[model samples]
Target: MAQDTARQAPPTAPATPARALLPLILPALVVGVGASLLLLLVNGVAERLQDLLWTNLPDALGVGRYSVLWMLVMLTATGVLVGLVVWKVPGHAGPDPATLSLHAVPLPPVVLPGLLLATVLMLAGGPSLGPENPIIVVNVGLALWLGHRLVPGLPGGVWGMLAESATIGALFGTPVAAALVISEALAGRPLKGALWDNVFAPLVAAAAGALTTALVAHPALDLGLPPLGRPDWGDLLAALVIAPVAGLVGLCAVYAFPYVHGGFRRLGHPMLALPAGGLVLGLLAALGGHLTLFKGLAEAAELARNPQGNSAGRLAVLAVVKVAALLVAASSGFRGGRIFPSVFIGVALGLCAHACVPAVDPALGVAAGVLGLLLAITRQAWVSLFTAAVIVASPTVLAVLCIASLPTWLLVTGRPQMQLREDGSPVR
Candidate 1:
C-alpha cells in the first residue's frame, strides 16, 4: 500500500535548476567589461579625430573653427570620405543603417571592421547621430562569435542578451537602464523560469559594465538643473502640455523619415547621396549655428547650462534645425544612432517651452519634453522614462513624468515608428 501510494503521487516537477545559472556568471562579467572597453575605445578615437578636424586643422589654417565656410567644407568632406568607405569597403558597412533597430541579427565577423570605420568617421565628422546603434551591433556580433567559439554549449541568444545589456549599461553608466530595457524586451517573450531568474546573468553583465564605465569615465547624465521640489498641480499641468506638444513635434520627424530616406535612395549611390546630404546639413548648421552639430550630448548640456541664453525664436530654430539634421544624417548613408540627437531636440524644445511660458519649471519642461520625444522616436517606454528622469535627477519629477507619459504614449502608440523596413517603408 505504501508503494502504491508513492506511485500514485504526481512526480515532482523538475527543480528550478538554479545550479544551471552558475555557469553563466563568469561569461556575463567578461562580456560586460569587454563591452564597456569597446565603447570607450570607439568614443576615445572619435574624440581625438574630432579635435584634429575641428580645432587643430582649422587653427593651422587661420580659419574660424566653426565659421560658415568651415562648417560647409568640413561637413561636405566628411560625407565624401564616409561615402567612399561605404562604397568601397567590404560588406558595404553591414547594410543600410535605417533598417536596423537596437536589437538586430548578429552580423558576420567580416562586416565589423568596415562598419566600425564608418561609425568612427561619422562620429568625428559632425553627423547629428549617436554611437548607440552601430556600437551595439559591433558588441553583439563580437560577443556571439567569440562566445560560440569559447563555450560551444550555450545558446546564441545568451551571448546576445549579455552583450546588449552590457553595452546599454556601459552607455548610460548605470545598470538600471540596462535592466529596464531588457525587462521591456523580455516582457513579450515566453519564459521558463521566474523573471528574475531569467534576468540574473544579464543583470550581472549590466552591473559589471556599468561599474567599469563609471570607474574609468565617471559619466553623469544629470544636467544640474534646478531642483524640482514636491510635485504640484502646476508641475503636472506643465508636463501634460509640454510632453504632448513635444510628441507631436517628434511625430513630424517620424512622418517625414520615409520621404527623406526615399529621397536619398533615389540618388542611386552612396557617393552622390552622402555628399548631398552633407551639403544640406551644412546649410542647417549655418542657420542653427555650431551648437546644433555633432551627436548632441555636449550640445544639449550647453543648452541646459543657460536655458535663457537663447531667445524663444532662437530656441525654436535650434530645435527645428536639429530635427532636420538628425533626419538627414540618419537617412543619408551615415552609420549612427538617433537617440542622442533626439535628446537634444527634446532639450531645445523644453527650453523653448520655458522661454514661452515662464510659469513652467525649466526642469519639468526638459524632462517632459525628453519623455515625449524619446517615446515618439525610440518607442521604448522604459528607456524613455528612465532617460527623462535621469536628466533631471530628481525624485519629485518622477510622478509628473509618469503621468505625462500617459497622454504622450496615446499620441504615439498607433503611429509609425522612426525605423524603416527592409523595403524602405516606415515600420508601422
Candidate 2:
C-alpha cells in the first residue's frame, strides 16, 4: 500500500512555476542597483586618482604628464603599491589573477578589500587591463556574502548569478549584453526548467543594473564611425581577411600568455614580479605613447574619433604595442580584465586596415577587428559579436560581422585560451 501511494504521487515538477520566480524580482532589483553603484564608486575613485597622478601632480612638478620618465615612475610605483597590498593584505587579494576568470568563484568577504585595493591601484597606475574581471569578482563576493546572510533560504549560486549578470549589464550599460552573456553561459549546463524560466531572474537583475548605470554614468560604446550603407562583396572580403588576421594577432598573445605568466611566477613573489612587469609595461608605454597606456576604452574612442590622424604604420604599431602591454600586465601580478585592452587592439587593427586599404569601409574594419580579437581573447562568442556590433552602432554591419565571425571562430576554437590554470598552464 505504501509503495502504491508513493508511486501514485506525481514526480516533482520539472520546471519552476512562473509564480515561483516572482519573489526573486525584488532581490534582483536590489542586487542590480547595488552592483552598478559599486562599479560607479570604484571607477570614480580610480578616475580621481588617475587625474591626481597624471594631471595635478605632473602640472605641479612641471613635467609632461605623459613623459617617458613619468610613465616609468608611475607604472613601477603602481606595481610596488599593488604588490604591497597583495603581499601584506589578508587573503593575498583572493588568488592569483591568472587563475581567475570573469565568472570566478565567490571569494570570501575577507578578501574583498585587498582585491579591490589592488584592482584600483592597477587601474589608476595605468596597466593595460580593465575593471571588468576584478569588479565582477568583488560584486559576486559581496552579493553572495550579504545575500546568504539576509536570505538564508536562497542558494548562494542564485546570488552569484544575479550579481554577475547585474555587473555585466552595468559594465556594458545594457541588459541585452548581460542576457546574451548569461545565455551563452547557460548553453551546456543542466537545467530543471525552460531556458527562459532560468533566465528570468537574471534578466531582471541585469535590466535593473543596466538602467542604473545608464542613468548615472551616461556611458556610450558607439564609435560614431561613418555608416556602412550596404556590405558589398568587397566589404565582405575585407571583414573576412581583417578578422582572421586580427584573430591571428590576438592568438599570438594567447599562445604567449602561459609563457609570460610563467615568467612572472618564476620571479617568486608579487613584490619582484609586479615591479618587473611594471618596468616592461613602462617600456611598452614609451614605445606606444600615452594613448596605449590605460584600459583601452577612451583610447580606442580617441583612435576612432580621428582615424585619419594616424598613418597605417603608426596604427599598426599601436595595435602591436597594446597587445604586448596587455599580455605583460595580465601575465604579471596586475588585477584586471583583458576585454577592454582587446577592444583597443581590435580598433587599432581595424583602423589600420582602413588606412592601408582606403576602399574598405572603416566601420567594417573596426567591427571585424573587434570581433576577431574578442573571440580570441575572451572566447565568449555572444560578447564578441555584441561588442563588435555595438562599436559601430549599425545593424547593417551585422551580416558581414556574422560571416566574418565564422572564420575567426574556427581559428580561435580549440586553441590555448588567454586564461591560465592553477598549474600555470593555458586552458585549451
Candidate 3:
C-alpha cells in the first residue's frame, strides 16, 4: 500500500512543472501577439506616410526626392500637423517626451490615437527620433485594458512589465537584450519572490514578441562589421582610453537635454513650440544634409558602410549635429524615444575615434566608442556593453568592453540624466 502511494505521488509530481509553466506561457502568448500587432499597425502607418513624404508628394511637386526646400517644407509642415494633434486631440497625446523615461505608468486608451498620430508625423517628417517610447506606451495601455477583461487575476504591474519587455525585445531584434535590460532594472528593487520568478514571465513574453516580429517584419540591430582578429594589447589600451572619451562626448548632450527642453517648453504651446522647433531642425538638416535626418538607423548604416570615407572632422560634425537634432526633437514636444538616435550618435562617435587612430582595431574602436556614449546616455552598464558588442558581433572584444565600461561608469554614475519634468524641478 505504501509502494502504491509512492507511485501515485510520482504521477502528480510531473503535473507540478506543467502547472507552474502554464501561467507564464499564457500571459506570454497574449502579450507577444498584442505587441506584434501593435508594432505592425504603427510601423505600417508610418511607412506609408514616409512613402508619401519621400515619393508621392515629391513626385507630385516635381521636385527631387531630397530637394532641400521641399525637405524643409515637409518638416516644418510635419511639426504643425503634430502640434495640431497634440493641442486638439484627447489626452494631449500623452505626456511630454522630455519629462518621460523609458518606463512610465501605462497611459489610458483615450490617448492612443493622438499619440499614434503624433508619432506618425514625427517619423514621416524625418525627426531625429524613433517609434520606441510611443509604441511601448501604446502597447502597455492596450495590454492593461485587455488584461483586465481577459485575465483579471493578473496584476496591473505584471501587464506593464510584460508589455514593456515584449516591445523592447521586438524593437531591439532580440529577447536576450530585453532580458539583460530588465534584469538590470529589477536588480535592486524589493520583491516578494525570487528574481527569476519575476523574470520568467517577462522573458517568455520577450521571446514570443521577438519571434512574432521576426515572422512579420524583422528589425536588424546587428552592425555586421568585419570580425575582430586575434587579441591585441594595443587595441585593449585603445578601448580603455576611447571609451571614456566617448562618455565625455555623450555627457555634453546629457547635460544639455534639460536646458534645451526648458527652452522649448518656454514657447508655451505646441502650436508655437513644435513648429518653431521643426523650422530650426529643418535648417540644421539642410546644413547636415539628408544623412543627418530621421532617427539615425539608416544613416548610421550608411556611415558605417565606409567609416574611413568620412574624415574625422566630418564625423565630429555629424555627431554634434545629431546630438543637437536629438535635443531639439526630444525637447520640443515630439512623440518618440531617444535610444535609437543615441545609438546612431554613438556609432558616429565610434567611427570618429577609428578615424583618429587608423591602427586601432575597427571592432574595438567602435565597440568602445559605443560603450562610453551608451553608459552616459542610458546609465545602464550591461545594456551599454551588450549594445556595443552587438554592433561588432565580436566575442573577442567583450572582455575589453567589460573592463572599459568600469571607468566610463565612474565618470557618469551620479551625473544628471537626459530627462525632464513638468514642474521644472531637477530629475532627482
Candidate 4:
C-alpha cells in the first residue's frame, strides 16, 4: 500500500489568543473614549448655537413683511450657502432630518473632521438640522478607523460595534437615547450577539461622556414637569378627543413637510434660493407672529409654561402655524436637527389639545399631546417618552406618558408618511 501524499494531515493553524485580542479592543476603546470626550465638549456648543439661531433669526430678518417672492429669494440665498457646504463636504452633511431619529451613516475617517465643521456651520448658520447625529457618526467612524489602522489583524466588526455604541452614547449624553436608537436601527437585523456588544461599550463611553458633558457644559436634561394626579374619567375622555385632533395635526406635519423642503431644492440655483426661503419664512413669521419663525423650542416651552395666557384661539393657531413654519424653515433650505423643533411642535400641540377639551388637566393633557406627535413623526417611542417626561418635570407623569406614547406611535406607524422616512431618510 502506497502512502498518499494527498491524504497528509493538514497542519493546525494558530488560534487567536487573548493577548492578541487585547490590542485591538484596547485601542478601539481608547479611540472611542477620545471621540466621546470630543463629542461631550461640543454638545453644549451645538446647543448654544441652536439657541441663538432660534432666538434671533426672526427679528434680524424682519420677518412678517417679506412677500412670497422675497421669501423665495431668502430661501435661495440659504440654498446657495447650504449647497456650497454640501458640495465641498458632503460626508458630514447628515441624513434627511425631518424623519425619525438623528441617524448618520458611518463614513471614512477623513470625513469626521469635515463633518464637525459642517455641523457647526449649519447649526450656527441657522439651517434647521441638529448636531447630535454628526457628533455621533464622526466619533464612531474615527474610532473604527483608528482601530483598523493600529491593529490591521483585528476583526473589523468588533471595532465597529464598539465605535457605534460609544459615539452614540456620548452624543446624546445619555445611554437611553443610544440604546433606543440601536434597538430601532437594528429592528430587522439578526440579533446574534449585538445585544451585548452594541450596548456595553456605550454604557462605558456614556459614563465618561456624561460626566464630561456635565463638567464641561452642564447640560440640564430634566426640566421636572409636574406629575399628573391619577387619570380620572375626565382624563379618559380627554384622551379620546386628543387622538383625532393630534392625529390630524401630526399627519399634516408629516405630509406637508416635503413640499416645504421641495420649494428650496427646486430652485437648484443656490444664490437665488436661500433669500427666497428667508423671505417666505419672514413673512410667515410676521403673519403667524414671532413664534412662527426659527426652531420654536423656546416658544413651545413658553407656551407649556403658561398655557392659560394664550387663549384657545391662540394655541389652536399656534398648533397649525408652528408646524407650517417648521416644515418651511426645515424644508426650504435651512439645516439643523429636527429634534428640538419637533419636540417644541409636539409640546405646543399638546397645550392646544388641552384647550380643545375643558375637562383634562392642562399639564397632563399638554404632556400627552406633545408626546403623541413626537412618537408619530420621530417613531422613536423611547425618546418621545423621555422627552415628554422631561417637559412635565414629574416621575408620575412619566408612567402615564409612557403608556400614552405607545398608542400614539402605533397610530402614527400605521399611516402613510408624506415626507419623513421611518429610517431617517427624507423625500428629497
Please, what are the lDDT tens digits per residue for candidate 3 over residues 1-428? 99888888733212234456567688877797789778877888888989988899899989987778977887888899999999999998999888777775688899988998899889888989988889899989988999989889988998988999998888877788779988888887865456676678889888888888888887676676786888778888998898999899888988888788889888999999999889888888887778778888878888877868898898889888888899899889999987778778888888888898888776777788888988887787887888888878888888989889989899998888877667754464
Q: Which of the two, 1 or 2, has more lDDT?
A: 2
- For candidate 4, write residues 87-139 as lDDT tens digits: 56655254443442355556786666655765665554433345555665676
lDDT of 1 by residue, 1-428 (tens): 99999999966534347788999999999999999999999999999999999999999999999999999999999899889989998878888998988775689998899989989999998989999999999999999999999998999999999999999999999999999988999886877677787789999999999999999989888888897988889899999999999999999999999999999999999999999988999889999999889999899999999978888899999999999999999999899998889999999999999999988889999999999999999999999999999998898899889999999999999899998998888897
What lDDT would each prediction earn against the true structure? 0.92, 0.93, 0.84, 0.59
TM-score of each: 0.96, 0.96, 0.93, 0.75
Off by over 4 Å in 1: 1-15
User: Which has the higher TM-score value, candidate number 1 or candidate number 4?
Assistant: 1
If ranked by TM-score, best first, what sequence of candidates would result? 2, 1, 3, 4
C-alpha RMSD (angstroms) for model 2: 4.2
Between candidates 3 and 4, the TM-score winner: 3
Model 3 weakest lDDT span, ten residues long: 10-19
Against the true structure, candidate 1 reaches a TM-score of 0.96
Best by lDDT: 2
